[model samples]
Target: MCTKFYDSEFSFLISTTEIGNSQIIYEEFWFYTEFVNIFFQNTTLQEKEKERKIENVIKERKEIVIKERKEEKERTERKEKEGNGKERTERREKENLVLYKFLLEQLMNQRQKRNTPNNPRKNKIKRNENFAQKENEGSSSEEESNQFETQFQELVDSLMDSNSITRCEKYAELNHNISHYYLPIIGDFFDDTLLAVKNSLKKGSVEEQVLAIRCLLLFSITLEDAADEIFNQFEPLLLKYSLEGQNKLKIASIEALGILSYFITNTGDLDSSQKILRHCISILKNNFIPQNGGHEIYIAKVLNMCSLLLSLQANDFIGIELSGNNESDGGIFFEYIVNIGKSFLEYPDLDVRISSGRLITLAFNLKDRLEREEVVDSDIDVDAIVEIFNKLMKEYSQKVSKKTKTKQRAEFKQYISSIEECIYPKDLITIKSNKIHLEEWPKIIQLNIIRNFLGSGFQKHIEKNFLFSQLFGYRIKVESHRQKHYNKKSQRKEQKKNKKYRQQNITKERKKKNNFENQFM
Candidate 1:
């Protein structure tokens, strides 16, 4: 009989043919169940593998997005930093520009105020006659002088400002441009300006004192006479600062004293110059000892001052005895300088060595001058100096190696060349078209010192300043084309006037001769 059977696990209907044949049907059903189970299991495993693959791809995508966000954030931060830096730089530039403009405007205002007419009668005078022209020119020059004095007074007043930065700026401006204002300031306003500077020197801070010292030196250059009372008044203070003050003040005071001594010598005050030289020598002797060797710069400055003073006053010291009993010998100072130079040649500091080399060169120059002057009986020993320099040259040449600094090597070569030049003197021609030939070491040193003092104004002074022209023995008669034309026109007018005067004299003589002949007839 046929029967319907249900398999719950497989959910399939089965028919039983017979009880005996049920075993085979059951076996077949079991096989189908196992196959279905295996198939379902395989499908489930495949679906799980697909799901795992999808999850891995999603995770990779998230990671990529996260990395991209991080990169974008970093880029934005970098851009912001660059933008901030640019902003800061721009702001500084803008501030500087503003300050520059303000200063320019202030200067313009000062100029306008100075240029404004002060005297109506002077302005009303017709500039037709030569006398009037001369008067106008003189008035204009006086007005310019007044203008400069006013501007200088304003600068000095500004230096007294409460703001240190403002004071510094004004001081720098005045110092840098002192050449322009020095002549005017030295006129009627000299006393007031001097007082202001002296006050600053006495009462102001270290920076102010330094600035005042520089200003004083610049003013000292404008002094026409060597025996100016200012020298006596300021000498003690300057000496005090040079000996007692520290750092920049001491250096400035020393340089000021050197320049003062130079001016004193220039003015032919050998007594004062010699005194200054002695003072400098005494300082050097005290400072050059091993105990004070740590102050190389100070020692160098003192050496430089001695060299400058000696080079300038070498002639005076050569043949003349010291005035007082303090020093008996005449040429002993020269020997002292030579000894100092010899001792300092082995100094490690470049400045000290250079200074010593200059001192030695000056000593040799002094000896050469003495020989040229036919003063053959001097105490200076030239052979010993030559031997020392030769040794120095050999030592320097041997010390040059790959490890040597480029600056040091170049300086050494230059120093050696300068020494050789001292031995065999050569003319050092300046670079200007109107060449200044410095044939002597003293002249070279003087020019160097003046150049350092005048800075940018050196060229201007060399061209137009009478003092510099005389000092360098350079006649700079720089006439512009317009000036030449005017001169030629004036010369022609003078020639025409002379011709008319000659013609009139000749006509009068002829008339007188005719009258005499008629009377004789």
Candidate 2:
């Protein structure tokens, strides 16, 4: 009975312990499962948060980039708009300057009329007016010129303003005065005036364009700085207008360019002077040809300018004539100019021919001056030049002889004399084969006889003939005996006239004696 009771108690103890152990195991398993679920949920929330932040950062960057691009685009557009505004302002300023030029011109014209006093009655009536009144009138005229000059300054200064005045005749007149007068005095305002003038050249009226160019030319002479600026800006314009503009415009542009060349030469810039010379030559070569729209008046105008340029005083201040070593085209420009002048002599237009003739004369004079300065070598083709010169002289000499009216003859004679001066005496001597004996002959005999005796020296004879032919045209040589016979004939005629006069005197005395004897009887 005791053993059975012990076994039951042990079984009951074992069963209770097992139940406690199983409960502990079940609770721990559930606790671990809950912890895992909580940890996974926290990880998922963190991942989602990280993804949202990344998306927000990316969107912010995109917004910043877009904002920068928009700002840059706006800045570019603003700059472009400002540029356009400035261009418009410049355009308006140029237009207003033109209007002011016209106004100044009218004032000048009115003052000129008042000063001239066209009515004789008014002048007579005014003559008895007070001397003080006359002085006052002169003073008033002076004041008007001063006033116009002042008005011109105002117009040029207006170029700097953003707002310009209304366009009118007064503006045009002022532009004219600025070019014609004010620019010569002050020569300032090149920058403003240059732009205005350029605008005028491009789109202004014919008168306006001419006035603008005239102003620039005056400005160039008044100031060296202005000259440099003028050449840089207006050189192209000069070529353009000369080729494309009307006759007046073309002529005006050529004059302006000629003035520019004078200024350029004064600076002693050989390269620049050469460029101008080349350009002028090219213009003559290209445009003066029949195939290239050659105009007689235009060609004549260009020839005149070329002559002026070739004869520029290379050293005006010092009075030192240009030498072979001189900085201005090395003194060789005269040759090129002479060649051009020679070409123009054969031009179809008579005006062109006359213009070329004048140019040739000036060129020859320049060459001689340089030679006198000993600037040129003696190796020059004096023969060829003399040949050309002789032909030119022959033509003019014939013209003089053929002319009937004194005025016409005088004109041709003047031309002939001018050309005769250009012939180098040395050239004639050289053509005479350096024959010193030829100088001993009488002036007229030398011309008529020595010229023929210069055989195989046709060019020399032509020059010799031309030199003496100014007084007499196309002289023919007389045979030695014939010349002597003519001299005897002239002597015989003089003797016969003297004999007749003596006989008449004797007969008158005899009649007087007879009258006295009859009175006595």
Candidate 3:
């Protein structure tokens, strides 16, 4: 207590030294000294109380520190256990993946070896079995098949159970299970699987619908022997979704159909493939117009599907052409395709334009290959086709040049030229004059010359200059108008600064006048 009192009074004494009156400062210092002396008498009891409080606080702090240590230890132990559990789980997952991969690899190898034509034992051993033995083996084989089917059904049921299966896991399972070897087995249970897929499509969530579509796509690809029946089942579903579903579903269905077209071709059903192709083309024709809402993505997807169909049917197309089969003649179809693709080249969307360019380029490649090869009679007239292609290229170039700047116009032309060169490698098409480059010239001189020629009645001057301008390269550099813009900007900034300075000076003069008036008052 005496120490605290002395400290406070000493601080007060130092503060009082700043007092202007020496008498007041002296009186304050003396009074505080006397008060401190009187207070020193109770210092012994206060010191004991302070010591007791310090001991009590130290004891409480020790207890708190111990409790915190215990909690920290428990937390560390819990974290360690969790970390170990996670590590163990991760290790097990890695092991399972490795095992699954090894099993899959072994299964694939065995299937390949059994199917290989070079396997000598494959043909020799199966012919010598007795009737009884064959009967017994067939019975066992049927039993195994039953067992396999049961297992597959259970797997599918489990995958479809929303309570137990996540959407991502279902997709992963679909991708993992659908392969060259197991595809046929999966197709054996096609009726139930297709029903499940359709159910998912109709009633499942978005993710389930996508997975179901993927499943159907894989089923189409792998169901070789049953392609006709399965495709008959699938075609309606795909058509419904492509026509009436939401945007994402429509895109998926279109993509799946594109993939399915290749498998359809593989079935050697050219008529069916052609029908599918025609169906796709008809859809594009109906929906590609401006009044129908030309969704660019859907349009691109349709074009892509058409390209896939054409690629698959290139040989068939050649045969049709060579045999002069007008009944199935796709000439009108090709004309429609070319027209659609040419129109799309002018689409505002870059992706739409690119897809259109690819479609046209692919069509040209098919036509050129068909014409150049000796496999066909080469009787078809491609001159009109080539002329149309040239017209398309001209329009495409004009659209591109309009969208690009002067510096990039030449570069853009080169890009277009490269695409053309790739499409027609043997005979390249070169632009004679890009009209965009011709239009952006400073034509003051030409205008004045025309004016003078007209004024002086030089009748042939206009014709000569027009011919020269078309035949020669002449351009004028236009002056930059940016300097005037910079001058105006600087003039505005100077005016603002001058206005600010004038306002500040006026404020200062008003203050000086107020101060002078206050002094007088």
Best model per TM-score: 1
TM value for model 2:
0.42
How many backbone clashes does every candidate have?
0, 19, 0
How does each model score on lDDT? 0.67, 0.56, 0.56
- The candidate, 1 or 2, that scores higher on TM-score is 1
Error of 1 at 205 (Å): 2.1
Q: Pick the candidate with the highest lDDT.
A: 1
Query: Least lDDT summed over 10 consecutive residues: which range in candidate 1?
Result: 180-189
lDDT of 2 by residue, 1-521 (tens): 11112234223211223553777557755765676688799999999999999999999999999999999999999999999889967855664554445445545655655696778998776556745675766665556556645655676765434433332233444444433332323443456677777776776778767767766765554343466668877788787787776877988887677667655765665445545555567788666775555477778777766655655543331222333234344245555556677777666556677667666655555555566776654334645655654564456444343433343333334445544554322213332233322321112222432233223433423433222232223443443433554465467569979999999999999999999999999
Question: For residue 149, what is the lDDT in candidate 1?
Answer: 50
TM-score of 1: 0.59
- Cα lDDT tens digits, model 3, 1-521, are 11122364445433343445668667867887787777785687799899999999999999999999999999999999999889966854653453355345445545654565654575455434434565876675555545555655765765557642454455546544553122344544667777777677777766677777777765654444344556677777787888876677887777776656555655576765666667677776677764556477787777766666666666666333322334344454455556767766656665666566656655655555555664333333445444543454455454455654343333234334434454222211113332323211112222322233134422222222222233234432211222343354467569979999999999999999999999999
TM-score of each: 0.59, 0.42, 0.46
Clash count, candidate 1: 0
